[model samples]
Target: MSEKATLKRSLGLWAIVALGLGYMTPTVVFDTFGIVAKQTNGVVPLAYIVALVVMLFTAISYGKMVRVFPSAGSAYTYTRETMGANAGFLVGWASLLDYLLLPLVNALIIRLYMESLFPEIPAWIWVVLYVAVVTFINVWSMGSTSGLNSLLVIFTVLLVVTFIVLASVQLYQGMGAGTLFTLNPIAHENVQAVAVLTGATIVCFSFIGFDAITMYTEEAANPNTVPRAIFLTVLIGGGIFFIAAYYTQALFPDLGVFHLLDDTLPEIGLYVGGKAFQLIFLAGAFAATVASGLASHASVSRLLYVMGRNGVLPRKAFGYVHPKFRTPAFNVIFVGAVSLLAIGPSLELISAVINFGALIAFTFVNLSVIAYFAFQQKRYKRPVDIFSYIIMPSIGAGFTGVLWYFLHADAFIGGIVWVSIGISYMLFLTKFFRTKMVDLDFDEADRPIGKEA
Candidate 1:
């Protein structure tokens, strides 16, 4: 039977932006800096700025590429078109881990927060229930998920902004003994470049899902609106996260609050304002985590749908779309089920596996941007210049490489195991499945004359 026509482009620019930010905001404000502080000793905001700069170049490349190839596959499409089918498939396989692990991490986090309130319910039950609900939301209709995501995003943004403003006011009023700004809190007196780069990696992980918007290109009202939304989402999301980290450091100069990383609810309320602030922060954190899970389910389902359409999987089952709802019905449920099963093992272990996949995907994305620009210049004589094509990617890869080095040994081992699984799967597809591969047209669009090469 023929597949249904591709999803209609119904999502507006603002909703698309909210969808991406909603996925990103929850963890960055509350969880990300805590990791950076552990590595850099409270200079987490500095690490955030550093990671933002590295990510900016990649974001620029992604912005340019998305306009030319407005498909649901994202980097999977770009790498395939410019490089080859094998390269694209590899990226797609790696990204599968990234998207799959995000929902698991989000659900686990939400489970932790919910346990604080409910206390009686088992964490595993909450994890299963959270994934089930999010999967249902994803399978119902894209329009419905987009609407809910928009509403949650508004609440997330407001809570984050309020926390920032309140923290800033308290610092200005000298309400606490913490320093307004000081490098003194950093653990090492003689900070090495490696340490900074390592800290930036952990910080950048928090910013991972900001690009999930690209997965919705096929469903966006205007494809051109995506590039602007991507840049804006990264800027606004990264900026808010950076500011939040700075204020957090200023309020609690010692960074002791972050020691609660292993703690369930992470007493951010006390550090930010007090009891009232804590409750508000907890509510916002929960909303953000749930939103992230919803967004993750949405994006991963699309990826699987697209991959199935391309004949890389059991197309009959994986490619199935909802007859009435017109969504990726099977893929949505598949991801949610996998994520739910994952939460039972160990939260920290799950987090490590997800981070490993994310870092690898990030590394490839940065490299793909460089490779794409280089291919463009070589094939079409397009003048992208050395700075964008060479310098930026080199710096991004360098920084990210260092960050990967500092990851826990267990995370590294888990990442290796995951990739090995992907490699084995790809080998089976080529041998037994013998899937036909298609060549992509990356040079369809022309560069403006006299542009820098």
Candidate 2:
């Protein structure tokens, strides 16, 4: 199949924004922050603020790089341009885990929720059904998937807003000096700062998907709109959602009242409003999981397609595009199949594996940004400030690295095992499945007519 025939630019700015927000849905953010809030009382918002600052520096670096090299490979392409093909391949290999694990995590969550509703249905059956439906959506066409995602995004935002509004009403009814505005909840002397930060690092996982917007740049209606969408998605989708969710948790003083660690939905619903709120929150949670599943499936397929195109994988099958749909049919099916198999048995394991891979990938992307900026200092003629070049990345990396250390030993072991698998696969590909590297100049990839390249 020819590259031009397979490539389609169909997603607009709003769609891209929805895509990012849909992937970073409130369920994920709330669940993550709830865990941290339980540990540090109401200080979850502080953790989010710190995470946002850290992510912003990386986002700035990504925004600059996206303007220059707007490709489907995103991080892989960026690393290859600055570093070498080998380093890029390693990053790509590691990232494969991020995309692949996301769908599995979603599928597992969906199964758990489905079982709550239909106790008779086997969890594995629900997993299979969820994967099948999401896979069908992903393979049908990019436009169809994006349209569904847009709808899901709207529903998700409304649900979250409803919860927030209800929570605010409850807080107001409680009258003067409610827990909503009190610092006392988070000012406990026993609360360790490092523990709060560590839990917050885990919470940062929900915000991770906004950067996945870069992966779709090749198909974005206007490539320039991507960075803006990403920024807005992070600010509004991740930032505001986190603030509302954490603030609501703060309004209710007792963390133990919710039983967060044991319950998936957390205590936000019960504390904020009541059963009505809990039901609405449950619906939103389901939608968020499904939306995230769909987004992750789409992204993994695209990453696989890019890898196949670059001859890092078996190009003959994975690189093939549907003659009519112009979509990566095999790649989508493959991701779905793998997700179903991987997540059907163990939800807890799936969550741990997914979060572990995600944090590692996040750490790498931030480090890549620092390296990219440092290398381009002379070419861009930008000020080579020590803070930008060294301090910021060091801080981000150190925090993330510490979080990686704090991950459960089982998760650490699982992540290490996955990384080893990726390395082995890369070695095998280099030895047997390799193809000549394509010579596409990223410098000219997004340039317009008569524009400097």
Candidate 3:
């Protein structure tokens, strides 16, 4: 519990990428496919394509910002450095809804999986055990957490590949669509603009974790590894989502194929690969939750550590790292404790508000690029500079802004309430806006590995 301790720099590019994929939870494509297909009128792949494009733009902005401010704080650091302390603190606060609750979301999903399989066991038992294991692994060491996460991600990816192969064979043998190549999955005569946009907003949830890669900047083997990892994570993860959505949408051209429209993974598994494969597939889904839980749990703890070290939160509690483990032990355990709330809320209710904070953070990161490069550095004088610093980030901002417009009203309300709380806390912390906020020592935080005392 030493304030002098810092996160160990033990992650390479592949380790960081695996963490990102785990956080994204590739199997989520199946769980959400039925709902998005229904919402998009069977054009789930098209919605995913739109979401991938939108996220790619934001990913580019994230890469650019990380090069300038390569700290574990991620969007919070970028926004604060370029924009101001107040905006950065608020963005970080709003981001807690997305970051903090994600571990609980994973816990909630695992409980659903367990209760479905073992109907006799109490649900809270699974949540407690799952949270405890994830928290302990993260608290133990970053290396072990990454190793376990990598294995889980690899397993889930293999299962997804198997499902696609089975679905392809079924389609070739005169199944739902009877062929692999078709425009129906992307568009048809009945597709509406509003519906696709709404579906895009929903599918954007699958793309959320790509940015979480930025949280490992301080732990990366090289400063440059982070940007490359961010782009790779988004493109690779997006490709998986797109391909899965296409094949799954083709296999079941209509919602009528699924008995449970909102939750179709089990039914899809039962249909595509039958009972034995369904058993294996369900196991993969559970693996995905564990992988995701570890990644999200670690990511939020780092974010909390950065904020705590900066005195935005309490310096002693949130900022302390275990001297031997070199992990933010207090923040990790604190997040695990809060994750116990997973027992009360339904997944649908939590899912509703998750996107609110993500879009807010996404929108600000995009704008932060323009604010820092174009306005602050005057980088817009040249054509290439204009494209990189101005036009690109503008498009990224506009795209996320559109998603914000299409966001559920419930998300808007929840986000506003959270922001109001953050505002009140900020007012009290700053003594009614009279005092200057405490600043982080970037030189000490990002010093080269050999330079650290």
Candidate 4:
């Protein structure tokens, strides 16, 4: 194959971080702030604090695994390489759930926001338009995708800063909680563990964008840059959420007055900054979702391309990148088609399932770290080694497992059904363990364009 046929390595560290934040959609704090506040009884920031700490452990484990594998397919590749083909196959299939639903979920939310703004148009129109636009940009160019992500992330940051300033001003003028500094948003007279845990689960979704950056494993300029970018992405994105939640809750501490959990932030925007700011906030949110939806769409396509090329899936379609654009053409369109499902379900129900596959995938990533560093490499001699390899990953796995345990029964059963289908397919493909491995070349998967030397 010619050099032009391979994936390009134009993404630098900052570009990767920007891509992760773009996938994360920092403005999401505004969208979910009221819900978290209600769930936590006004201690939204504490939930984010817990979520941030939990994510750091997983981020550390992910950094370790990506350093070991240093290829595409994210958790799928890590678990497969460390555990076995069977484990890898199932994890990859599990990830398929996250990757497939994310774009659809984003589109659904985007459609809702649009419906709120312009009620006359049918919601399907918004979903179709967003799916088409984002799909076209992704298929057209990787540079364009990252570039758009950078712009959107920057705009979101600016909008967040503006909201903070406006909310702070309002608080100083004796509005809402009438104070900027208060333990009320982090902890109160009667903070409950169950409430915090529920909020933590919702906030966990906010941090998964860093993990999604692993989809660009083969495309990063330096593979080592990936781990650093992942850590920074989580911290930076979490910081935004922390700050946003703190002020938003401080501005509107009363959850009973929120009336509409789905559109609470917009109501706050109107209360604190008036109708103009409310519209601007809505625009910022819509933009944030687009950035998120676009990055997620790109990630899932790469996943299918890698698995398809490896014979874990159909080779002719998902495996085939466009000759001119060098993008996963078929997988791109397929994910867009699946986004149509967003139109049927209640957005909240679909959103519940998002965390299921993601949390499971994360728990295994922690185990992958233990499998690689402690068992495979036998590097548990030193205190640092034992801590990083065994202790941290163990904590991460246990924490993520707890979150998975608490997921809605619908998501729990749905996840089981999804995994069973993967297991069944694997059994059929491998003939009950007769074929041990798929012919996947992680090196060939990441083989850069300028490797003549």
Candidate 5:
């Protein structure tokens, strides 16, 4: 295919926000609520609040990078331009676990959720259905993907609103606690510092989708739209998460009563709104899963396209866009194929690899910001510039570093192994930095990261 077949720019602010939310999946709050509730000893909201704070710095760092290099490569592009090809390659490699496995996770959860809803149906049938639907939409066009994502997001948001209202009514009518507001979800008497921090680490997964908004910079109507979209993505997602956690926690004060930790939210759905509510909740959650898979599918394809076009990966496979739809067809289909692995792995194992890769990529994003300003070029601004470029990223890196340290040992091991593989591939490509590779011209790549090409 010719270079003219590259991704076409058409996304506006709201569309970008929808895509971000789709990737983040506001409904993740339900799927993870039980574990977070257990880990924090009933302080799920506080854990989410803490996670929101830590992720804000990472979001800010991502926004800053878009200004420097508003290209489709995301962390890979930013790291490569500011840090160098070698370091950028590793960032790209680590990020692969994140961009790819996430869709697989999203797809698998829908299957698990569906299998639970309708036990007669085979799980693999649901899994294949989700992957097929997501891949077809992504291969169509960003406009179609964004539009469908927006509608799905609206359904989820409305479901959340309905849950809050129903839960509130139940509370007022002598439900658990018999009150709408309480500090228990924020600071329970039995709260442990270690437990709260651990819960925060898991809650951190909910925040992953927001930074992905920047992946569409090349397709955004205005490059500036990318950063503000990132801000809104995080802020809006945080609002939904906090409200859901607060109400659900308030409704179920005693986490110890639940026989199975994973079934907490589904059971709570019955308490707050009965079988009808449970059905709606499951429907909303399923929609969010499909939408998130679509968003993740697109993101991984773009990252692969950037790598492929740059000669970072095999250009023949990853570099081309479809002539008609102007999408990264090969990569989209490739990721869809990879998502089939969802049928076998334990959710815990997949989650471990995803989180580890996300933290590594987030850590580099923070470092990339510092490097961009301190070593590459520091744009002069009154005061916000210094804080934006240095102080904030430092805090983000610090928080991410702590979480990464406390991450499950399995995650650390998997991440290290993944990186080791990347190192071997990098050596083969560069001949140990004794060779120079030609990058696809910035103009042809989509958007320029720097002020000039």
Candidate 6:
């Protein structure tokens, strides 16, 4: 028989890391700084620190899981292989909220940016244009997506460095904190543990892209490369967030300076640079949005493709990879169709909704490690294994659980509704648990390069 078409494996460590960074959208730190600063009482950097520590544990757990079960399904694949098909299906279903809505959020953000720049234009026009371009690029090939994403990421990084330099110059000239090296940015008299923790919960969303690296395992040059990419994506992305937050908080240690606390990037650009620089800042922001849109759009399509291949979703549409392009062309187009909804929903509403899936996926991935290693493999007898398999993931799970407590009520409402749909559909597929889900083949062809399946 002729072989089945598979995902082309062409991504190196740097290429994969670039996609992760693009997915994280490092420029998001500035967009969110003012809100988090207000929440933490001027300690935005400290809040990010807390978020980073929490994300690091989860990143490690993700790396551990990807090492054993290197596949494109990400949390869905890990949870399914370790837990059960039913559980995996549900996890993948929940993650659909996060993976799916993220691209929409990016499109929404672009609409807002365009409306700000050209109020005469209809917002829907911008949304359609942005989604069309991203969809086309993704459907073209993974290589094109990776190359474009890398360039955009590099541009954004340079912009970040420029902002830091300007902020430092202003700080030294006796601005907000009068100098860069001070605990004032990290702490002050009114600093409260609860407040910082609350801010941490909010900023935790900024680290969402790190876990996404696993979605590329099937495409990595070395499946083993995925683990390093996952950890480095988190470390490098977190470092950018921390350093940028430090300078920004030091420049304006209080919320009084920002007219729009919800989104301080514009005011930050105006204050630190000028009208000319504000345009540059907005351009950087646009690049970040486009980068994020491309990455998230690609990710959700692959997740859908994997589920489709396993019969959880429709086989013909979701599972089909184009023979010429070697891309999940149908799923990409489907996601583009969904991105049209960006015109209707407000960014805040969709943002909250995505968090529900992201945290759920993270929490379960941690549990999957314990399930697969400690129980399935009985690797907890050794002290090292106990620490790696038991203690660390437990901490990761606990941290995400705390964040769950702080999730918006709107998220609960939206998430519960989505989960209900997944349950109904899943029941129909399984005929009310009377039969097993069609087992997906992870044959020799899908394993990391240089490894036997």
For every model shown, the clashing-pair count is 3, 0, 0, 0, 2, 0
The TM-score measured for candidate 3 stands at 0.89
lDDT of 4 by residue, 1-453 (tens): 544455678899999999889888887776677667766788889999988988988998989888777765477678878888788778777878988898998988887777767789998998888889988987886444688778888898999899999988999999878988887888778799887887788778777678877767788988889999899999999999999988988887787766558646567777878899999998888878876787678767776777777777888997888888878889889999999877777554666578888888899999999998899999999999999899999999999888777676778788899999988998888888797757453332554222332
Give the candidate number with the greatest TM-score.
4
Stretches > 4 Å off in candidate 4: 1-12, 139-148, 215-222, 320-327, 440-453
lDDT of 3 at 175: 85
Cα deviation of 234, candidate 5, in Å: 0.7
Relative to the unseen true structure, what is the C-alpha lDDT of residue 270 in candidate 1, on a scale of 0 to 100?
A: 57
lDDT rank order: 3, 6, 4, 5, 1, 2
lDDT of 5 by residue, 116-149 (tens): 6677987899889889888888889754457877
* Predicted candidate 2 versus true structure: per-residue lDDT over 408-437, tens digit per residue: 556778778877887676566566447433
Ranked by TM-score from best down, the candidates are 4, 3, 6, 5, 1, 2
The numbered model that scores best in lDDT is 3
- Ranked by lDDT, the better of candidates 2 and 5 is 5
Tell me the tens digit of each residue's lDDT in model 1 across 282-396. Answer: 8778777776777678767776775665566777987677777778789888988888774565455565566676666556666776677676654324445676666676776
What is the per-residue lDDT of model 3 for residues 193-277, given as tens digits with 9 covering 90 to 100?
Answer: 8889888888888888888787677888886998889889999999999999999989999788666564578778889999899
| TM per prediction | 0.83, 0.81, 0.89, 0.90, 0.87, 0.88
TM-score of 1: 0.83
- The TM-score measured for candidate 5 stands at 0.87
Instruction: Please give the lDDT score for candidate 3.
Output: 0.83
* TM-score comparison, 2 vs 3, better candidate: 3
Per-residue alpha-carbon lDDT of model 6 for 140-206, expressed as tens digits?
9654468887888899899999999999899999988898799998878999988887778778778
Clashes of 3: 0
What's the C-alpha lDDT at position 305 in model 1?
A: 70
Query: What overall lDDT goes with each candidate model?
Result: 0.68, 0.66, 0.83, 0.80, 0.78, 0.82
Give lDDT: candidate 5, residue 259. 50
